[model samples]
Target: MSESYDVSYPGVRVWCRDESGSSSLVVWRSQWTPEVIRIETPTIYNRTVWTVGQARVLRDVLDAAVRCAGGGSW
Candidate 1:
């Protein structure tokens, strides 16, 4: 099994390994950034940063998706 966080959007899947200890560091990637999967393994990895605003936007979008999909806990 892989140790990573994942989320599915309308037509996309985003994921990233949980390697950081900081609460603010959320590195994620999707089909558009294949390098995230190509380079990262259980022992080695890379990260792409998202700004606070970007992260918040993602959070909001995900919340909306969940709401539309019959409302689930976030």
Candidate 2:
């Protein structure tokens, strides 16, 4: 199972997720147009764009990964 939450941000819909154990984050340009989602992983400093509806379904994989290597939260 996974847990997800929406974090408030101006002009954007930010989500955090933790799946099974691994974590990652997803951000949408806005709630009006959620077709595109940006996937970000802080651990490796990687970002990618996905357009599938599944992206929204998987938004619950963003968590812990947002934390810095030194145990700092982002």
- The RMSD of every model to the true structure, in order and in angstroms, is 13.5, 10.2
TM-score per prediction, in order, is: 0.37, 0.32
Weakest ten-residue segment in model 1 by summed lDDT: 34-43
Name the runs in model 2 displaced over 4 angstroms. 1-26, 30-34, 59-74
| Deviation in Å, model 1, residue 43 alpha carbon | 14
- Which lDDT values do the candidates have, in the order given? 0.47, 0.50
lDDT by residue (tens digit), candidate 1, 1-74: 43445532222233444565322223345566433322122333434345556667766997798889897643
Residue by residue across 1-74, what tens digits does model 2's lDDT show?
A: 43455522332434445454555454544565566656555445657667767665554343434343344333
lDDT of 2 at 41: 56
> Model 2, clash count?
5
